[model samples]
Target: MLLPMSIQAKSYGWGFKKNTNHQPPDVGVYKNILDDLGGYYLDNSGDKVVYLTFDNGYEEGYTGKVLDVLKEKKVPATFFVTGHYVEDQEQLVKRMVNEGHIVGNHSYHHPDFTKLSKAKMKEELESLEEAVAKITDQKEMQYVRPPRGTFNKQSIQWANELGYTHVFWSLAFVDWNTDSQKGWKKAYQQVMDQIHPGAVILLHTVSKDNAEALAYMIDDLRKQGYSFRSLDDLVMKDILPEPIIGF
Candidate 1:
């Protein structure tokens, strides 16, 4: 679905048509606003590479396994964590940083930024940053994946003005709901079926299926000649027109 055309406060849940052709899903009309305000959905290159990311709203007891899989696979990823996650699971957040992964801001209260004033948005980000700073070595939060995948031009603009880059996803599935999981094999198949070049994949840490299928996914993807990269690499690519995707 398209985001509201106006520049006012309108909440938009991020979505796109699912593709099974190993290509980036068309983001419809979000291309313009994202391109104009530094939002990234996927890498613009056709190389066989992917960026792994997770949204941690609350712990479902699988992040440790997810981290273990990443450690075993030596794949660097970014975990966008909320305030509750940080406050509740400090060591896990610390482990994310100590293990060479990025800890992105998923906001403090996990509220809709479009409905919030710029100052409230800043407060939300900074509060999470401060909470994370006390527990992890990473002090400044440079990336933001909006709560519930919702945003607008004003929200993106405010984030940019606050020295943050908005990151959307090019590859995702219906894996967030814990009540109706489709099993690990289904999750694996979903990713493998929709896999593509330079895809910014969005997965939830709350998914037991994701944690179970992560290592296998990494191995099989590598077997397909794809290399996993970090969000740092993605951001650098955005800043410089080098060999990065999503230009």
Candidate 2:
């Protein structure tokens, strides 16, 4: 049995205990809070649908490969990007939008929303949305991945009021430290071992291993009977009740 978790309005660095049992992570009260706020980390449809998301702060030359793999595999993904990435890689950002992928906001300067005022949080999101809008066909950004996975109840509430949905991850690993990458196999195994139905998988575009393992991972996950979904699909599925869908 799981114990009830108490939530506070204070700043929180988002994290949860990973389960070897390959289940949706135990996010305690965080999940409930997000659920009520129209934010989500897991698909509630109880189906074998997986949403792939990537955090691109500043590219390390592997995003193109990742994009190529996604294109080849015909998988849809959401790329949450920072202002620095947009300023640095406008073409890549355009490509992400042009190739039928959703580009999400990771904030303009990549600051902790929990530390910013409501106005400033809106500014951060709107600024990134504007930057992305300038370079792509996406005129609006609807999802946000808080910088460094940090947020508070108030921060999330502000994002909600600002028309952005907070997107946290149910599956992730230490693939961000560019200096400590193990290998493609390790990345593949880590994801395979942790994947679950309705999971929102977070991968960093800076990870070379992730760039290399993405294709294989897609194939294997498809073989496991999992379907790839976009964040738009995830949110739409959520908005429409389970029974009402496909009726």
Best by the lDDT measure: 1
| Candidate 1 residue-wise lDDT, 1-247, digit = tens | 2335565656678998899999888888798778876878888867788899999999999999999989887899999999999989999999999999999999999999989988999999999999999987898889999998899888888898899999889889988899988889999999999999989999998999999999889999989988899888876875776774321
Backbone-clash count (model 2): 0
lDDT of 1: 0.89
TM-score of each: 0.94, 0.93
Candidate 2 off by > 4 Å = 1-9, 241-247
Q: Top TM-score: which candidate number?
A: 1
How does each model score on lDDT? 0.89, 0.87
